[model samples]
Target: MNGESKIKINMKAPLKERKFWDVIVIGGGASGMMAAGTAAKRGKSVLLLEKNSTLGKKLLITGGGRCNVTNNKKDTRTLLSEYKGNDKFLFSAFSKFSVEDTLNFFNSRGVKTKEENEGRIFPASNKAEDIFNVLYKYLGESNVTIQSDSPVVSVTKEKEGEYFVVKVKKGETVFAKACVIATGGVARPETGSTGEGFTWLEKLGHTVIAPDLALIPIALKDKWPKKLSGLTLPDIKITTFLDDIKQEVHKGKILFTHVGLTGPTILNMSRDIGELLKYGSVKMEIDLFPHLDHGALRAQLQRLLVEQSNKKLKNVLSILIPGSVVGPLLELASIDGETFAHSVKTEDRKKLVDQMKSIFLSVKGLLSEDKAVVSSGGVELKEVNFKTMESRVVPQLYLIGDVLNVDRPSGGYSLQLCWTTGFVAGSNC
Candidate 1:
């Protein structure tokens, strides 16, 4: 494959005159771009098809445009724990192209990345375009043909053998010896991730998992949370219960939104929230002071009242909670903000302590799938070979990225899956 021979094509090209390709990748997200470039760099005639006007539309907005490339958790076992279900399927892929390999790949391409809190990596320039430019440059130098705005109308396998005929809109069909479906999941439809790949896989005798929202903001049923919108608590613990039974607990930052909660802790627990809602009623308790037990919190409150007898109750509470939440706390405790600390009855003080320790909120539901940061479902993992990212049910057909049923957390694990599986598929295909 050489730049002189490889050329970008459009739908206007005669269908019959289209060059047969060694590999044809559908979608131009992180996985498709990486797969096409990797295959082309290995001397394969690769064709990258993107329905969007440009490649890496979703990648441009990842990590709020900073693009968290990957995480620092280099150990495969520990990293696997961050995922939700069927994560063992990633062992082979992660082993082949670990986080170190990802960093090395980008570093070699001159996209210097820096590590942030929780081992998250971002480009030194803090621009997602820089990351995209690195991949785009690699694809160009490797002579990978790119086709933009050419949405595939249908995909069909030849009557015999391992060849695939990909038909695009306007009656254009291209042939390839191998095909990679990297169209991603239905997380962000605006980014061209409408889960079309799953439909194609299902037609090819593969089981497609029902896609749902993952890493999405949750809506609260109470109006109190809405009034606290834009307020961010640095350290808090959230415990989710289903029908009065504790299900799970997470500790981290929690941000109040117009409708509900959105932050690392809440988003991390959202998948379970969606699942638990089906079984029974879902409720979450927020511990304003997770570091202290109930007894310790009560004792601390008493000490605060003793130390500030002349101060207003609101002033005494302001030391423990943010000022924005002080008024709401007093209201929840059924105490006036202007009441002096010494005048507060023991029962009122106890109410204040209990409210401070555990504030409960009813769970409504999750946002739409398209608004999710990462989708939860796709082609069943058992149907694909993780070692090569090739479909076991349909030979010569591969699946990568969100099109597979691997649910990862927010940080950078999802993109790492794209890089790893895409590279494996490209190298094997």
Candidate 2:
């Protein structure tokens, strides 16, 4: 589906006095659209406010536009553990509407989903448009009104009544009995997730945690990484060290970028890297053969040498490492890449094995928030009711999605949180 043609909201709808909607969901992202559609399904008049010309701007780019819908994990605790802060805060929400329910919701709407490795779910068509189409259809069928290009500026609660007044960019005041802040976080600002909801929540007596870039690429201090850009190393383990102390390790595919490192493994550990950077310089080690230890790697290298004794050392090493990364790996080990494999000394083989086992890179910093897949922080979890997603400080106010303080890795966990919180908020609101 064409991205522009989706989200059929009445863009030309004039701003005028109308009956107060039961719920006004600010931000038409994954969570906002879900909340609006679910509330409208429950017979509530809903208005979905989108800052962009279309809804689901961020959603369309999720999972490289295929949109990892949700994970297939049935264990609630295991699922919540993927998140960063206060995993227990989502117990009520996930218990109410889970990953299974998310899959069922889409499947029931004729959008078939399939699970990939690690329980990551994606549309059977491999098109994020399919997921958005399901939501757009739901919004249309539920009679949920949407206002595109209508960015909500501030939300103020009435002193004498239970209603809240939502002020848009043009100073138009839209009244609603309940307000759901689904505006998302600061990640991917081009997608309209600029963390505006954090400011609004802060103004309304909620503690807004300072958001940092999460699930994003990391900038490296070494220039060799730029040469290895575009090469993908699969099943490698990356360990992050904070001032020489090991903090975290992740194993998955890592894609080399012009600036630094990306892919699931690096993005998942980026939050820890961000924190580790604050204290001192951060360093990371890559274990190419994580399934094998040093002695086993040496044995494997020995076997490779015997198998390809006539080949150049670089060519022999290329069997274990990517062709693009082989030259650099040999250089780091101070070994001549052009040396004959059979003539290589045992000490040289050991150095090669050590370098292959623990490739080192000093992390310069993280990419900006706009480059992140999800922001690391949001409204502090203590201020919101996990059961209804309602704000404990402000009655009739609900915060969901990236607006909460939950941060999860890729592989469908983040979107799963969105689905769970969005559904729970919609069910209660």
Candidate 3:
């Protein structure tokens, strides 16, 4: 397949003139690009269609415009663990093109990459365009035909056989022997993932799961969190509870947003928070100083009061917390920041320590799909042949990326799934 001839086609001619193709891939995001290039590289005349004017629009925005190339997790089991309960279903696909393959696929092409905390990989230049350029070049070099801004209206099977007929809105109608549905889920509609693929799959006798927000910021019921918007705490512990019963605790970096809380920690727990919200009210207690006990924190605060007796309470507490957070936090604790540290009552001092130790907040709900990093639902896991990423219900039809109902957390797992599934689909199709 490596020495196969690359298909050359003229742009000026009608795309329908060719009439037939070896493969047709809908959607040109991360998985679509990888799948198209992989199939085309294997001597298939692959046509990649994207509704957007350009390919990889979503890819360019991933990881804040510095695309997370792949997780540095080399071990198959450890890497698959991040996929939640769907790990078992993914073993076969990952065995075909694991995380190491993804890293080598980019690194061998001269894209220098660096590993950040938590084994998250990114381009050394810190630009997502670098990642996109590599894929675009691969597709071009493989002679994969691309038709941008060509929104696919429907994908119907030719009544007689295994070939797929793809109809592009206001464009051309073409046929292919094999079709890969790489259209993503309903996460970021602005980037062309609107769940239209689910409809096409449903029409083809596949059961489509109702999509829900997965990795998204947590919205709060209280207004105090908004005051500290843009404030990022590097290390903190958050304990979640449902109906006054402690559920689980997670520790990670968190960012205060105008609406609520976000960052890696909150994003990772958003799905569980959403599940809790369905049954009962969800409450979260933030532990600003998880490493110290109550007595230890109180002792530290008492020492601070003695040392800064001449200063205002706010100024004294500023030594412990960030200066910007002193006033608002004091307000939340119902303490007078203007009081002199020496005049502070024992009860008031205890109140300050208590608030600092456990800041209470009510979880209103999870943010909507538009704010999500990835949506949860799609074609069910049992419906697809994970080894090949092909639909069991429809022959010659494959699914990849967010199109499958595999839920993964933030920090490189989602993109890794895209790479593995895309490669497997490309190899088998």
Which number leads on lDDT?
3
lDDT by residue (tens digit), candidate 2, 272-371: 7888888998999999999999999899899999999999999998888778988888789899989988999999998988888888899999998768
Candidate 2: regions farther than 4 A off: 1-11, 17-19, 243-248
Query: What digit string (tens of lDDT, one per residue) describes model 3 on residues 338-426?
Result: 99999999999888888888888999988888888899899998999998999899999999999999888888998899999999998
- TM-score of every prediction relative to native: 0.88, 0.91, 0.92
Q: Please state the error at residue 229 of candidate 1 in Å.
A: 2.1
lDDT of 2 at 425: 90
Q: Model 2, residue 155: displacement in angstroms?
A: 1.3
> How high is the CA lDDT of each candidate model?
0.86, 0.87, 0.88
Prediction RMSDs, each to the true structure: 4.1, 2.4, 4.0
Model 2, poorest ten-residue lDDT window? Answer: 3-12
By TM-score, rank the candidates, best first: 3, 2, 1
Q: Worst ten-residue run, lDDT, model 1?
A: 1-10
**Candidate 2, after superposition: displacement of residue 319 in Å?**
2.4
